[model samples]
Target: MNNQLPPPPAQMMQLITGFWTSCCVYSAAKLNIADHLKDKPQTAHQLAEATHSDAPSLYRVLRALSSVGVFKENEDHQFELTSLGNTLQTDAPGSMKAMAIAQLGDHYNAWGNLVYSIKTGHIAFDNIEGMSVWKYYEMHPEEGVNFIKAMSGLTGAVIQHVLPEYDFTSFNTIVDVGGGNGALLVAVLDKAPQAKGIVFDEEYVVAETKKLIAKKGFSSRCETAAGSFFEFIPENADAYLMKMVLHDWNDEQCLQILNNCNKAMKAGSKLLVLDSVIPEGNEPHPGKFMDINMLAMTGGRERTEKEFASLFSNAGLKLARVIPTHSPMFSIVEAIKE
Candidate 1:
């Protein structure tokens, strides 16, 4: 087993051409190819007819994705879903279909202007789209719903790893601040049956969240609140959970949110912030790249432990500990209200 790095030019070429794979996967996802292939193997011609696409062009995409292990090509040119491909199924657990569309659709233009953001220190999405991502979603409700589904998909992927690492059973009440669609809170409440929850977010978002809560048959134990985290949060929950929330803001905005959480928190309560805590030094990490995505789209960032500690202190909370999960992409940054 060799531990040496690949030659620089070869590695750089792979890095530069990474988008080829992304675009191919996006095409597959957009066309619902994975869902079509889920029950049985199908030739690209069959898939093309089902998707209303050109057979030859669709075959090329399936062939490309097959090389990357997203699908498998057989002797007769039939394509079948690999385990990786199954994740792109719309109804699959932790589905990435919506995420694929979003990243390649709405987020594509903003990411293309990343150089502009780098040069001017402005949000590329706002510069390119002429509105904040949130407002853009509001004006485009279909896209907004897809975006929410994308977030829920992402949360679904990570929650399995998170629940085992942290205990939610102790809290009698949990508030998921900026909880989109109540997925995380619902999962937590399932584990902590003694705990009731509130899914707190903007008015538009919580409307859908309420329906989800009722659908999950948790309507009595969990409720939805419509409001912004900047102005107010529901007061005095035993625990507040913010998963992938603070990473969408800059330091000043983060402080405002933290402060609001502080004001709403009762003494001896805990705030569990689930986000990527970028470690120090040059070891490769997903958060390092996600940090760039933040810069390009939201003017936000992934924080280091030191950064989180400082942010917590500024909001008058004590950084209790940073708990690692099975996945390195996230950590539980636990803080306490004294």
Candidate 2:
């Protein structure tokens, strides 16, 4: 007989009610609680007054978080930042503060409407926000800026992993398609000093990129262009690099962008797609969860290697290889013009 016991009911309940813990972390990050406690531990009332929250309620939240090692509860309801909590600081290395803000503030609503997305096969963000997530951000530039910061925080470490693993020396000009803030392109140019770079994005976004490139003293080697990927991309590029762009779109929409890139590519040019590749089976993978998030938020899906190859073939490109990075969740999917 198979002798095994299920987890305790309380443990199962904890798994089911896990969003509460996430919200606690989000609230702490949003209120800048970690930064406040950086200097020294402070009473919950002190933090409450600084953050304009209720003392007792804040104490409850912090106490709950302490159980998860985010913060530590001390004498007199004082709370101190743990190592995990330090990552929520805005200026900390690999900070996730902005991501917490965006996810808890705007994304929370979309996730709440996930059941509707499941039923309708459409994005819950559009239904709840009454506009596409992109349009909503366009209308609210401050939130849009935060959204970009959030993405940068998420992508920054991944860029470090990508820079060393990929070979950019072979390419003369690399167009960073949908490159935000020009960080990736700037990093690429920094490594491959001989190669010139272009940050291709929306008009408003490229305007920001111009400022960043100039600020980074890369104005000479890196430039900016404004356009939509669905319509056209800069032509005759040795490589077109897109990180996390394809996952924001569905298959048909991705084909539109790829077709545009294919039209813009020369015979020997390459297309580099950087995103998560969902592995087959019931294995635990971040891409599997991210695929559902894409479904709820953008009407997109993370794809497997076969799915990626099929997509590339449909766009008249040949899948070259999928290179793994130190970051297990991300990979480089390279293709060549055919």
Q: Kindly list the per-residue Cα lDDT of model 2 for residues 121-151, writing each as its tens digit.
A: 9899999989999999989988888889888
Q: Which residue pairs show collisions in model 1?
A: none
Candidate of highest lDDT: 1
> For residues 106-158, what per-residue lDDT tens digits would candidate 1 score against the true structure?
99999999999999999999999999998999899888889888888888877
Measured over all alpha carbons after superposition, the RMSD of each candidate to the real structure, in angstroms, is 1.4, 2.7
* Candidate 1 segments exceeding 4 Å error: 1-6
- Give the Å shift of residue 174 in candidate 1: 0.5
| Angstrom error at residue 196, model 1 | 0.9
